[model samples]
Target: MQHKHGISPRMEHYSCMVTLLGRAGKLDDAYDIINQMPFEPDGCIWGSLLGSCRVHGNVVLAEPENASNYVLLSNIYAYKKMWDGVNRLRDMMKTVGLKKEKGCSWIEIKNKVHMLLAGDSSNPMMAAITEKQ
Candidate 1:
């Protein structure tokens, strides 16, 4: 359709196609799109591919073939319970000095938001929140 209309496909459009292909178990086609895209594939694109690989147990592109896409791709694999993928990603991270960013959360209350970090439980009612959960 894009070629028919002489319209250049946007990054988002390409990403969406990749996502759809992944969802449909057309991982080979998804990988082809990533490899053939005119623009560089971003983390989202690689992440989508990684997710498909995990679901299908296809390790063709499971390795960090492209370093730039490693971070998100590794994460997607990890989320899918691929320990080997996680280890590979960790090794790549060590090689590139890329530490996983520590997770943090923000809570919005009364038009004001409070940021909470992993170990910094500065919330006044931390005990109450834990009890409820």
Candidate 2:
């Protein structure tokens, strides 16, 4: 449809297509789309693919460079009681210096947004917020 309208599909479009295909259990099709895209797949595209891989229990497509992919695959292996796989992934992460990033979140109060990291208490208003709760 895009080609018919003389419009070129962009990265986001390709990523969305890949995500849809993956969700539908069409991983091979999604992978083919990624390979055939004119532009190199960016982090978002790879991330989507990795997420789908997790959903489909297909870690063979995961690459080591993407820390998140390794983490997800490791978690899947752990869930399936595959200790060796989990340990191997952890060792790989250590060798590559890819520590999983801390998870953070944001909330809005009184029209202001506050960023919060896990186990964080450094924010000036943290005490106040905790007291209020």
Candidate 3:
């Protein structure tokens, strides 16, 4: 698009390109495109690569600080029932002093806001909530 129409490519376009190349097993080429992007890539870009890596059994992560990246990889390993990989990632996090913070959600009802943390069962209405779900 840039060369033919003078229009810069957006993140979504790059994402699609990466996904396409990744699905075709052109991981290196997909990574090359990410590197060439003028703007810094966000989670979506890395996510595209990570997904391809999972499918291809290759882990190529350029980011180190984001906890979410680790979580994503861990989730992939868990999905595949690769217990060893999951444990290794957990150990790596401990060694690196990285902790995955608990995720939370906020909901408002009757003008009152309530915060709920992931895996939290302290709420008195937890049983009802689970039953509702």
Best by lDDT: 2
What lDDT would each prediction earn against the true structure?
A: 0.74, 0.83, 0.78
Candidates in order, TM-scores: namely: 0.56, 0.73, 0.59
> Using lDDT as the measure, what is the rank order of every candidate, best first?
2, 3, 1
TM-score of candidate 2 on Cα atoms, chains taken together: 0.73
> How does model 2 fare in lDDT?
0.83
Q: What C-alpha RMSD separates each model from the true structure?
A: 6.8, 4.4, 6.3
Q: Which lDDT tens digits does candidate 3 get at residues 1-133? A: 8999998899999999999998898989999999999899887788788878777766555233467668768776787788897898888898888887787777665676667789998976556555653
**TM-score: the better of candidates 1 and 2:** 2
Which portions of model 1 show Cα errors greater than 4 Å? Answer: 3-6, 65-92, 102-133
Q: Taking the tens digit of each residue's C-alpha lDDT, what string does model 1 give over 1-133?
A: 6769988898898899998999899998988998899989886787678767767766666655455346556665666787897787779778878665555777765677777778877787555445653
Q: Model 2 Cα displacement at 64 (Å)? A: 3.2
